[model samples]
Target: MSSHQPPRPVRFGILGCASIARKLARAMLLAPGAAVAAVGSRSEEKARLFAADNGLDVATTRLHGTYEAVLDDPDVDVVYLPLPTSLHVRWATAAAARGKHLLLEKPTALCAADLDAILAACDAAGVQFMDSTMWMHHPRTAKMRELVDDKDAIGDIKVINSVFCFRANEDFLQNDIRVKPDLDALGALGDVGWYCIRAILWAVDYELPKTVIALRDPVKNQSGVLLACGATLYWADGKTATFSCSFLTNLTMDITLVGTNGTLHVTDFVIPYEEKSAEFSVASKSNFAQLHIGWDPLPSKHVVTTDLPQEALMVQELARLVQNIRDAGGKPEGKWPAITRKTQVVLDAVKTSIDKGSEPVEIAN
Candidate 1:
């Protein structure tokens, strides 16, 4: 037999016990390189309940009554923060100051400026910083990215349209933290539009668009939180993209990319319909058959499979990076934080365009 040893699992401290945190805790269990070491909330009882409800053993896991306690825990190697958008800057910087690697939830902050402060702190502390955009870690996303980059596969992308929407029940509409002005504020745009904007940017190799224009109409709640909206982005090279996001419609996570020589379509871009596999359709070299009764080329579907869910994959990646920093004296990966900044920058642009009454906003290079 070989004399190799198993890798040490990265210890994770979860803060706030947000609804999303439960799913992330499960994801941590799914990743071989990660483990939940502690959980903290304003109420120690709440944290205890969360741990119990989530099947975390109280004897092995520490439960704290305050967010600071979790950050101060020496056993915690990384902090999984799924807190509200507004609270990101304060807590994220605090975590970094304590030398804890951060796995922040998406919509990293309410605005780009806030995110900058958080990033600056992480930089100073030399700690890992990554946003929880789970789908980005999916194997299917890599396959799609490879296909788009291969000129022979789909040629150059000319246009893209993406949407992430789902209807919310009355209770959620009235009381969910996402709809609260002081909590999420950005609402549907932050909740769903984030995925769309990321997809558009990824299609163009993360190039910032030349301009962004918000759609004419957007639905907002009484507190002025966005509930539905759309925006279009223009690249200097003539490539264009549009995306829609909403909480007023049936569930739909779709993306369509039209290229010079071919096209691609994915119905579930954010969350795949099934856990084991995901699919996308592609068409190339279209020509009419004799008599033009039907198209000569038909789109074909490609399915990509993964043993672990995308969220688990995300945790695994962060764990691997954190391990390197902790054990091998390696620096944190810059790619994740860099891409996260780009996503936030683009998001701020869309919000600005909307606030300016749909006037096109120029994106600074």
Candidate 2:
């Protein structure tokens, strides 16, 4: 809907009592066209406590112990899931069957096939679905795209390198979701590497690589803690992209796109906090004059910061969904921002490559 007037707020039902849900609840309060009307948790007591704490214990407010109950609510136009990765497919499917739009966390499903199922279900139900890949929506990332498309900046993309790692808590073994068996199995690739892959996907306009090679060195159980892993992606355009993700390694959060004319470097690529500034730079391979005449030379340096908090991205994503729903007569297209079948295809290829000793796996066209 073309709206100079504000759209009606989208009432949301959140599944799970995830830490991220709290942030989303706060964000929903701040978001212009969204409202958290209900929350569901496995534990009735927990749901009650959270609802009371959030001042949602009012007579009209809804809070329930089971996620299914949240999905059954007629008031909820969309459901935001912050559940564990394994539970994604089941919950997402159920939500879609109930005709509720879905906002899933990153790395939407275990593999591409599962994501496809989630998308198909949503499509059949005529509801929208999207991964909360908020990084893709930020201005800094948009600027990076501009530089990549610039002929003088990086003429023909040749390679990409990215790393996102942080040492786990020493007592991670004691008990933590990150180290849990199933999640650990997904390893760093699904956890953080996915961001790097998706970033490159967006940069290259979602071109699927022709070949992929992955290596996973599990330091522990079947779900080995991804001490370190590397991937080699061969694209049809003779461009090769590679990235490493680790939890046992030193701190690192960076993505560098190397092209023919110049290289674009992005630090803190994935989590561009509104309060914290991210650094971006592009050094042209062409002479200073060529850079000036042929293109608007990128600022030698750029910083990303929003007056809002880190949760602002989530807030913005939800707001976009609400606006789309209101404008489209309540039948929004795509999931979240846009859940495509391609996302799952690439993810599946990566999983197969990792399982087969990082053997080069071909992505089906």
Candidate 3:
């Protein structure tokens, strides 16, 4: 005879009913060992509407009128913060002070200083801090990591190029919070370039770039928010990376990595075209065989499949960690916050380079 029980689901409280929260709320439903504790918005009615619209169980999930109520809720083990960039530091720090683990959204702060405050609070509170960079949790990303780390597969990486862009309608261009200076001030750079930067760093094993220089002639909106931009990153050992992002192009998410012995390509790095399977190609030591016609060996396609969506995987990972802390008395994991900080630091360098008229900004160790 055997007896065992399933782990208790970690309760999640969502702060700010941003549109992205709907997807995350669904993800929590799919993730193992996770449950919705509450959801909050500026208005209780709005929060109720979000819950009902998203098919959240209103009978079980509490809806709070103000963000503060969710933070103060005794049952919330963690908070999923999807607020604007400018409000991240304030709400995130407060959540930590109240002993809530944090799963913050991307563009975590307006700047590195603000992020530091949030991090400090989390560290002091002995709580986990993870950013909602869902792509990082995908199974395909793990396969790619294995290949990139294998010296036999892709020798020394030399260069990386990435782009993530999407065309916005007039309404989004004019009224979207992403285009608002007081909200997501970094605009396209914060929204889209964030993925590109994270991909580059992941490819390079989270090594901070030595310097970053913004490309010339970035486009900006009337409100002085970036609409399109590009930046180049340089490493001390001569490794280089370039990325561009925009709100004025067709939907595209791509990454191309060139190494000493091979090249790697992924068309949809941020969000896979299909949820069940994702693919990437690699060409190892490809060379001309005949009279300058074609390469000797064609690139090989690798596919990774998963049952749960990447966002759900993200939620599952957070929930697992929360359970460890609650049931087994384990300390919070530091890996996520560390990588997120590196991403933010590189992002800040890119912003600084742009502000300095495309001048190179050095990244401190």
Candidate 4:
């Protein structure tokens, strides 16, 4: 770990007392060097209730009404924005102007231009900016990357097929900003499809696709629900990847990679929140049965099950954030600018392709 001060565990000021913020607050409690110093909601009464429910010792951080007030608090060094996708840019820009380190939820903006502007503002202010693509920080993802790098068992990868779909309950629509039309197109892609894309790109060394073709069901107006969508991502080197995402079905997160010589299978691209172990398979295209060598990557096979930690991945991410801050003497270099920018650009391109009737769009890096 770097020897820098590490920013004193990043006093977190959460914007909006949403359920997800509660989870993040809980995770912050578990994450070393991090704490939910304060939480703000439109209603002070609600914010106080939330703080009390969480047993927060510092009640002063629990403010009511107006997100700007939370950002203005001197006690808050890092602001975790869990507001709706549409509100991301406005709040992120404001928080950046205040010189607070930012941890915004994914799809930083509805379009690439907005994302670029937000990043530019953050850059101008020299604030550390991070999108909460928490899965990228998961240890299992690194394990999967290791598996791919160790052998390239998937062999000259040709296709990347993935899906993240689940039928959310009817009650989930209440007051949820995710169902708005302008924001809906980014629904599944940002919410769940981004996970598939992240896994695929990371496995392939974050290569940019040459061209992308996408399609969405227009007849069904579920506002933000991406009932079904598909993308054909063409790599520069002739390799291609195809992905599909939906929100009209039961929860299914699966990723399968096929290559000329072998195949790699990720049974649960997104597993149970309590997942402790992941089951993966590899075999040559020519011979499938004989080479089935499956083993637990965790401490022990028995202990290696999908019973995940209540605060595992998010806490882990916060730990890394602290370390990253320390590494840069309180400001890291590079700082995932490409990932954050590219994520929005690609998502926008995918939406364009969908609107253009699945016509292919040239993807820029």
Candidate 5:
């Protein structure tokens, strides 16, 4: 038998009892290099119930009555923060200052500046920081990126279109935290637009757009929160992208990229229909068949299989980074935070454009 020691598991302390946190807790358990060390919420009973409902071992998972207690746990090497966008800057900075590696949820902060502050703390503490964009960890995403980068396959991208929408029931519109201005604030834009914006940026290799213009006549609730919105991004090289996100439409998720020589299409871009496998279609060239009945070259479908869910892979990757820092004294990886900042910058610009009556807003950096 080979004598290979398993890597040390990174201890994770979850900061909230949010619905999403249950999924993340499951992910942490699934990841080989991660473990749920503790869970915290305002109500001790709620924390206990979360652990019990999520099938976390009560003996192994400590339940804390307060978030601060979890952060203060010396056994917890990382903090998985699933708090609201508004509370990100505060709790994230605090966790970083406490020298805990951070795995933050999407829309890392209310704005880029707030994210920068959290990053600054992580830098000072020499702790790893990563946003929870699970799709980025999917094997299919890397395969798609490889195809897009190949000049012979896709050539230079000219346009990209992304749409993500889901119909919310009446109760959700009235009671969901996502629709509350004080909680999520950004509503549909932050809830769904984030994935579209990230996909657009990823297609362009994270290049900041030259200008952002919000689509006119955004639908907002009475409290002034966006329920539906869209935006257009323009690059200096004539490449353009458009995206629409809404909470008022039927379920749909798509990303279409058109290049000089080829096109890429994926219907389930944000969340795959199946957790174990995903597929994307790509067409390199086009030719008319005899009588122009059908194209000679048809788009080919590529499917990727994974033993674990993408969220689990995301946790494993974050745990690996944290282990590097803890075991080898390695500096935090900058790529994750850099891409996150870029996504947030573009999102901020889109919001600014919307507030300015859909005027074109120049993105700074």
Candidate 6:
């Protein structure tokens, strides 16, 4: 008998027909070990339309009128939840309690306390939990991590800066769910700032900062939702990080890490500009040559190619974890939830600082 084991597919039930769910549905189709088994929405007709529009096979994919029906489906091994920020804790906890693994959207919950409740439910039910930070699964990110972690190549990291911003059109400003207080309470700070905060935390290996201070005079919408904001994070060792996010700027996503002996820069940090390949630049031990006319060493670009998009890779990884739990009786991985909690902690601190008149706030945990 051959020793090769065929891939085990993970059946995913989408909790809502959100726009982001469409991208993940396509990813599930692309992932070899994942399949979209069900789609659910407040409206049955809307769920059916979503399945048809997203090219999910009607024979294979179940359409449910209510989110509860999807959670109650016995065939679903995983639930991909892309609900609004305010709704994550309720739906995610319910899915986990039903023995379905969770692939939740980022800004996992409104705050750390709320996220902990969902995580606690998952832990009690013995189900895996993973936030949908697609870039974390990309090969390019792994390669970059290797370089940044290497002492000789990057030296001691001193500072990190991340920025993620995009101009919102009139429709988005007026009608987007993100700007609605009840929908996404933190607004731009929760939407794009989550990525920036995650990037900074990733650079520091998920270490919590000592203090967080929101920049003064954050731009707010008419409904008192943040439209543009920035924050500074300070570590005990003087390792500092800063991030800025906005809904009123030109499209830009960047991360710059400066070390004692080197520097790293990436233009497209959150989502790669190209789906097929990604690139980052690094420089080490460089100084101006002959009166600053030219440099003796120039930054080198590293390119990583991937056959499948980052989102598909994320699905495959989550599926693999689910398969391990199903076939091998493996304990759920704690790394994803741990990382998510850390990100949420920082996010909470920023929001608290902003609420307190942009005063400095110490991270409680």
Candidate lDDT (C-alpha), each: 0.93, 0.73, 0.94, 0.69, 0.93, 0.94
Residue-level lDDT of model 5, residues 127-172, one tens digit each, is 9999998899999899999999998999999999999999999999
Whole-structure CA lDDT of model 4: 0.69
Relative to the true structure, candidate 5 has a C-alpha RMSD (angstroms) of 1.5
Tell me which of candidates 4 and 5 scores higher on lDDT: 5
Q: Which of the two, 5 or 6, has more lDDT?
A: 6
Q: Is candidate 1 or candidate 2 better by TM-score?
A: 1
lDDT of 3 by residue, 1-365 (tens): 12387877899999998989999999988998999989999999998999999889988899999999999999999999999999999899999999999999999988888899999999999999999999999999999899899888899999999999999999999999999999999999999999999999999999999999999999999998999999999999999999999999999999999999889999998999999899999999899979979988989999999999999999999999888988889998989888988989999999988988999999989
CA RMSD of all predictions = 1.5, 4.0, 1.4, 4.3, 1.5, 1.3
Candidate 3, residue 199: CA error in Å? Answer: 0.6
In model 2, pairs of residues that clash are: 1-327, 112-344, 129-335, 129-336, 130-335, 130-336, 214-358, 274-306
Mark the regions of model 1 whose C-alpha exceeds 4 Å error after superposition: 1-3
Q: Which lDDT tens digits does candidate 1 get at residues 1-365? A: 23376667899999999999999999998998999999999989999999999989888999999999999999999999999998999999999999999999988999888999999999999999999999999999999998899898789899999999999999989999889999998999999999999899888989999999999788999999999999999999999999999999999999999998889999998899998999999888777888999888888889999999999999999999999999889999999888888888888989998999999999999
Cα TM-score per model? 0.98, 0.86, 0.98, 0.85, 0.98, 0.98
Local accuracy of candidate 2 as per-residue lDDT tens digits, 1-365: 35576666778888988776777777667666677878889977788777777656446557788999999999887898998888888999999999888888766887777787888788888777767776765667767778888888778888888778777666754455555656534666677777767766766678788998885653443455444566778898898887777767776777888778888787777775334556688877735555366544544777766554445565566657556765565566443434345655666677787778878899876
- Per-residue accuracy of model 6 over 1-365 as CA lDDT, tens digit each: 24487756899999999999999999999998898989999988999999999999987789999999999998899999999999998999999999999999988999999999999999999999999999999999999899999988889889999999999999999999899999898899989999999999999899899999998989999999999999999999999999999999998899999999889999998899999999999999888989999987998999999999999999999999999998778999999999999999999999999999889999855
- Residue ranges of candidate 2 with Cα displaced over 4 Å: 1-5, 51-61, 216-227, 273-276, 286-299, 309-311, 335-340
Candidate 4: worst-modelled 10 consecutive residues by lDDT: 295-304
Q: Which ten-residue region of model 6 has the weakest summed lDDT? A: 1-10
